[model samples]
Target: MSDVILLAPHDDVAVATRDLVPGESVTTGDGESDGNPTVVVVRDRVPRGHKVALRDLPLGSEVRKYGQVIGRTTRPVPAGSQVHVHNLEMPRMPDVPGASDAASDYAYATEHRELPVPEGERPTFLGYRRADGRVGTRNYVAIVTSVNCSASTARFVADQFRGRALAQFPHVDGVVALTHGSGCGLVPTSEGGRTLLRTLRGYAAHPNVGGVLVLGLGCEMLQVDALVAEAGIPADTLVRRLVIQETGGIRATVRAAVAEIEAMLPELDARRREVCDVSDLVLGLNCGGSDGYSGITANPALGVASDLLVAYGARSVLAETPEVYGAEHLLTRRAVSPEVGRRLIDRIAWWREYAAAGGGTLDNNPSPGNKAGGLTTILEKSLGAVAKAGSADLAAVYQYAEPIDTPGLGFMDTPGYDPVSVTGLVAGGATVVVFTTGRGSVLGCKPSPSIKVATNTAMYLRMHEDMDLNAGRIVDGTASLAEVGREIFDLVLAVASGRETVSEELDLGQDEFQPWLLGTVT
Candidate 1:
């Protein structure tokens, strides 16, 4: 097997497949080797998953990976030297002519290709069909808290349904308490308040939730009645509300909530999973704890599966706005229209200002864990992160927690934080999520199942029980990318058909229900 993987022919760097010592030699080709190869001797001791310069680079020279500009050389570096933060830095956004604005490179829909529908019979999954015409991958009772004051009460109510509490109701997926840190201090009309309300309403109306108990502290700014009114849940859907202050206290509210949930259990359990078309599925795409191999292995494989789902007329949502900073141009070119492309660029612009307000730049990403795993800058990471979206045309772009109304592939503006990102996706109506991680991220989302795909074999094996699938096999050379992608696509149907993910078996998603907090707390 080759010691390095070169993604594109004109790339300036190759990812070290294994640790390399000085004087070690590796060969590069256009990913698929044409008979001829160029050999470069390793000048630095490059660790596995890190980058090796394919040729001599002078100061300010742009470094390319995935055939895109990742960053630029900070100093003159010899070929075969390790290329990383010490020798490379993010390019000034202004210097990169077409990065943020309309330039010749920002052509809209230039790379957009309409997805051709599959010829065979469309695939199906066993799902709970809701009265509202939505299909649910899981049928659960949700205890949604309107304010932080009611969070504990909501959790307590959900806790009552743990263990064998719902054993008799075989179809029920158990109760989940959707709690968060902010709800009351901010003005309801503020961006943060509106975002919190949208997130809460989205979950209450989420197809995965068969019944909901909206809990709140009566004195709080986000009132229970207001949330219920705004949720627009079907009249027949079992939705109840409880106010802690009116109910006397947490104990009383929990008791009332538990009883309400108990009353809704039979109805929820009676909702059987009927055979539903794969088109009814909304798959959320996310990545966390990423490493260098992320872009090469799991991400691309997931992208292929995303493309397959889009071809089937299903919606696949790619989120984590900040993570996609540098690669926005790729998505813009694939936009279905100039307006959709502009919407994406506008979000990117918002992120730049948001970051600046906090005294940081969009390049503040590529977290410590990412750097340790060989990712050097946000540019490199964003290029890799965008792979999860596949090559589908950008159908629509949405604000954080907005309802996902479009069919094909869509983008949701959200923070790069794992739990928060997935929360927005789930709230936006994703029935299932596929999360790719190179450095073992054990994140899960209830109401919606999260399928964790590892980018490298060693981490997958080390954290075998936590991960649902091993895309690492692609990097290991044991399985082709298409095979693993098919495996993921198949697993999505299976999981949607009631198959349990590793996170579900471990009961790991209840606490991961974090709504993105925007604007100010007060």
Candidate 2:
């Protein structure tokens, strides 16, 4: 094979698929060794899976990939030099949400979700119907304690609702023990502390929630009444708050909380689900423990599936901003407008500063698991990560924990932490999720269902119980990416309509409801 490889024909740079030895005679395109075309070795070592400027590009010129500019070059670069952090810069764009002129980007899709599925369509699942008319694949009630001092009581109360003992409340999903370390040790007026309280309140009032009984130590930074007032949920929502100090300490609090929850069991058990459209579904596209085949098999499959959901008017979300460093140009071109594209570029730039302020580089990603999976750099990993967005036109992008109401393919700003990222998506209104993994992340989001797709067969078999579908078959040469994509699309509809994912099956969303903490408190 030739030493140089162009990713996209109209792009400005080519990435080295393998190491280029010193003075090795190689052609830029096809393997024809011409007498003279153009040649330059700008470095003693050009690592595999790194980018090499395809031509001698001058400083301040745009570095194009996926036929769009990813960033700008800071200094003149040689034809074969590696383009990276030292010389490349992610541009700054403002954070204002700009309006985009509506246009059709789905002309290629002849089939819409409104079209009838052919005969033998088996898209069905048993789901729960909330009071607000939203359907849930899993039914869960959370014993949310607003204070760390009452955490033990919350856990003790949740224990009563576990396993087969929960059969009496058949309509109620699983019960969760939601507690945290922050209701103390900080100023009650602090934004950081207040944001945490709002996050906890949001969880208490989430639509998937059947009922919530808040426990408090009565003197924490986040008081139960404050959480209740901030959440603004109606008393008829089967939610209640109890204070340990007011209830005469821990034992009294647990007894009083259990009595309060048990009182609503009969009412909550009366709720039922009806047929709902796939459009009611908001799906989060995520990847973790990724490998080489993640981009090839699972990620692309998820992307294709995401497009299918968008066709049906379903909301599909892509997150992990840091993971998508190098391959952002593709998304920028697909942005709903130049303004939306600029906002995304700006976020990328801000993250670069954020990383540097803490003494790190934006390229310091691609964890050991990613490396073991044959991904050599952030660029390589991001190229694969972008596939989860599929072929849909980029619709909207939101910051971490911000409300996401717009449908179609959307991007949410979030860190690369699997649990935290998924939490933001669920909070932003994704009722179901499709998570792709090559390295086997045992991630599960209950209440809002999660479907895990494995990149390769080995990891799938090793973590079968945690994983729901096997996209690895595509990499094994037994199935095509489209086939798996179709399967995932069907599964999304099933889960949306009422089927349970493995994580939901295991009552696994108990500890995953965490909010993204942004900026330090003064």
Candidate 3:
């Protein structure tokens, strides 16, 4: 595809992915005009991955993408005006009581647009099917622990099973240390502590895990046996546990864990990749450090990928609730039913109160960096952030870190914190994650791998070592959305089948485990 032109007909602006010089002639639709469309230099010089207007419009007009209003036109837009925050407003109702009779009727006019799905194609991917009926895109042996006390030992155990030791085991994809801090801190009887242990148990018992070793500092509030008993996990030859206090501290624990892993290695590496059905894939979608162009390019393209995955009977999880603020109504409509939509709406309300309790407002978002990048309000950002899910039917809505039951397209209640948000998705059974960013967030998660998509070409080129795919290629005038979506889908399979992402190679998953803290410490 030589040129990728995106102009939602209602939108008066069109974005140019590459740098266009002053008075440099360019053509648009049908045939070339006698003269170049009058170009207004929005910035000192137009850069790659930025935007340009399609035609002039009156002030207060809207800028559309994904067939939704991302922002409102500010100045009287001239033909080919470089439209941005300086010349736009977030799509918010006039903050006045009954300002205009048409105001109440002004809902998302672009919400009803039909998405064009390519004809006659069976989009599919390579994956693995588990005994529990869950599908996995990756194979991993996880060294999980009940609490922080066993974290170091867990890491020690996984280090002994690195993929390079193929001489001993070849079928194994890799090993990860999945330890967290909640195993012993608070009351074991409290709902929070009990929930924490359950999460740990779920991870250990997850079908994607080829083998699991649960470690604990025996004297901790959460006993290793307590997790297995309550969670109903089977006690099998593959399930092993080491108690540091009983095993004689870290040294003894490490030795015990190593021995157990050595015994399981042969079996863990014996499973090979079989052609699993496409329905076995569950993709997790997230975005970080988003800019104005993020919604227009990277996020939506990823959404296209999400749609493809779901259309093939797989699953897609769109998360980060706080970021979805003003644009939530769009997702609510996609919810499987009114109840599902209402549940999501309720969560948004809770977040508003939650933010206020902390003396913050939802609209107070748009970090300084975001504003500098021409993003004015949370409404504008949400419109962009929501694009990563594509247009699949919303099948379910889950609570933070809650198990992702029932497939197809879904929404998981999660915070906007990248590390925490991603952790929740992984814990909820997502075997792979796709993270899109405009300002560039170097983030990753262990156990389940993440594919980073860069929203701007400059960031992608600068951070090439971190980003796996450049959705910005669409913005740079080099690729099409569908093409990049295919590349991302292929990479998901590669990473799932043993290929490492930038984060995995750099060991970026260790510090990314952050659980959402809903209440205060006493």
Best by TM-score: 1
lDDT of 3 by residue, 453-504 (tens): 9988888899999999888777566888888887877787677666779987
Off by over 4 Å in 2: 1-133, 187-191, 230-236, 519-522
**Ranking by TM-score, best first?**
1, 3, 2
lDDT, ranked from best to worst = 1, 2, 3
Q: Residue 177 CA error for candidate 2 (Å)?
A: 1.6
Off by over 4 Å in 1: 29-35, 95-105
Better of 1 and 3 by lDDT: 1
True-structure lDDT of candidate 1:
0.90
Clashes of each: 0, 3, 3
Per-candidate TM-scores read 0.97, 0.76, 0.82
Lowest lDDT block of 10, candidate 1: 95-104
Candidate 3: misplaced stretches above 4 Å? 1-7, 10-126, 162-167, 187-191, 230-237, 368-374
lDDT of 2 at 60: 89
Encode model 1's per-residue lDDT on 1-522: one tens digit a residue. 578998887789999889999997898753634656768999999988999998999999999999999999999989999999899999887523222553444668778687687688889999988888989999888888999988888888888989998899999898999999988889999989889899999999999988888889988888889898868675547888899889989887777778888888887777788999999999999999999999999999999999999999899999999999888989989999988998887787778777887998889888999999999999999999999998999999999999998999999999999999999999999999999999999998998999999999889889999998988777678999999988999999999999999999998898999999987775
lDDT of 2 by residue, 1-522 (tens): 345545455566654545666555434563223423344564535555345666778998887654556567889976766676567765543332322211122122222233233355333444555555555554567777776788788889988878897687777777788776667776666656755665676667666777888788988767887877757443446777888888898888888888887887888778776666666677888999887667767999999888877777667889999998766667877877766676677677777777877998777777877765555557767888999988887778887655556778889888898988888777666778889998888787655778889887777899898898999777456888899999998888777666678888777876776666654533
Query: Clashing residue pairs, candidate 2?
Result: 125-498, 139-173, 289-439
Worst 10 residues of 2 by lDDT: 98-107
